[model samples]
Target: MDRLGDTYRWKSENVSTAEVAETLGHFSGIHEANVYGVQVPGHEGRAGCAALSLDDGARKDFDWKGLAAFAYQKLPRYAVPVFVRVLGTEVGSAASHNNKQDKVKFGAEGIDPGMKGKKVVGGEGDEVWWIPPKGIGM
Candidate 1:
């Protein structure tokens, strides 16, 4: 996991999701942008290539393709994120030393106006999707 952690550190320090999306948006002029990765089932190793979001980053109004292509281009074949989980609202459990802990059982479940496109990012019960590269254009 050292390499994975290294990559994460590099990404967090040198490139960010928003920055990547913004760059993709500037070049593509698309409405939505995001990057995700899929973890291999039964494997504790690194995740597979990322799944890009092709939607505008706006809630209730977005282009999911924009998110997809941006990720496809910036990430090597393997480092792309796997999920396009939308956070209806950002929550913070605790932040210390500039690091924030994950908030368990967080989502739009039972919460109105927050379930649309809701996805669990990382956890035991997280659902994985295999989105075909049908519409995203590089």
Candidate 2:
């Protein structure tokens, strides 16, 4: 049996990072996607967030709304990532020594723009992008 703790809960629903990552991976613009649970101030539980690496030149044309819509359609409401971070050119920067995606740093960073300058193991000077909760702008 699967334990709830193994899967983080958001809005009273269990969220599987691997499942979300797999769904996000289907998008052509996303070269790589890393999913994790992130603490949101005043929220009952951690919110879902995705760290994405865009394909070459895709940033110029990346569609945030489309991605949001896709996520909404493919995942449960609670599983849809509440935030997204766009990485810089070096996409593998967030990977572990074995090339596996690492979420510890990202989870700690949350969605604060103030955390921008902080450095991750292999991710120095990487850019981060996210949609504010208001959904008015990116």
Candidate 3:
């Protein structure tokens, strides 16, 4: 098993979680982002997943496609997140001391379409969105 750390391999390319998170932070409605790799069945490397906290005014009608476009524009093809977890404004377990983000829990909860939304994000209003292989334009 590969150790989870500063970078992870996906689609034969090394992906930097910090870099992806920074790219996501630049998007208009995203207030916070936590990027990490999660295991995918039958895949050789982990897939990127981003957990997001939105701005107060942007939650209801947040532009998902716009964010996707931003990510595609700013990051390499391999680094674009395959799964997006919406945490609303609730910090929950995504952060800890000194406001540093933690990716363990989120990483464990891979983008399983079978899992209920609230169970993975820990909030009734939270959501999990994912793009299947070749599903999205990315």
Candidate 4:
């Protein structure tokens, strides 16, 4: 099989997938979650941004700015989750744990601007902003 070469060279510079996932899980209030890298302007690492999918099925995408804000508020810079991409569909959990609906799958794109305040599965109650953090300068 062809080697799965590192598609994101920038990711090597900083931040690990484990760290990203852990941070997102702690902040998003979800047990199962996945964090992936996203490319952004001016950022050194492609993984500078992380897209997190939670276990409860509530997804929210946060950028560096947003992550930093969360970090400042509760977590440290290292624990700050950047570039979150919320998912609309449910994500599965690890084998040891029950297969719960992953909410972090809902990225910024999945959320509709009109439904920002509306309650969605795996998301906050109605009236909460669903807009991606990056869209609003994080």
Candidate with maximal TM-score: 2
Task: Kindly give the number of clashing pairs for every candidate.
Answer: 25, 0, 0, 26
Task: Report the error of model 4 at residue 30, Å.
Answer: 2.2
Ranking by lDDT: 3, 2, 4, 1
Expressed as tens digits, the lDDT of each residue in 1-138 for candidate 3 is: 444555778999999998999889999988888888988899899989888988887988988877887777788888998898888545445565556676766676667645534244454456788754444564
Candidate 3: lDDT over CA atoms?
0.76
Tens digits of lDDT, candidate 2, 58-133:
9899887788777877887778888888777444666667776767777777777777546464344455555444
lDDT, each prediction: 0.36, 0.75, 0.76, 0.40
RMSD of 4: 8.8
Model 3, stretches more than 4 Å misplaced? 1-3, 91-93, 113-125, 132-138
TM-score of 1: 0.41
RMSD of every candidate to native, in Å, equals 8.7, 3.3, 3.5, 8.8
Question: In model 4, what is the error at residue 91, expressed in angstroms?
Answer: 3.5
Q: Candidate 4 overall Cα lDDT vs. reference?
A: 0.40
Tell how far residue 1 is off in model 3, in angstroms.
17
Indicate the residue-level lDDT of 87 in model 4: 40
- How do the residues 19-108 of candidate 1 rate in per-residue lDDT, one tens digit apiece? 444455454424333332223446444332222223345545554565566556765434455444443333221112355322222222
Question: Which sections of candidate 2 miss by over 4 Å?
Answer: 1-6, 119-138
Q: TM-score for all predictions?
A: 0.41, 0.81, 0.80, 0.41
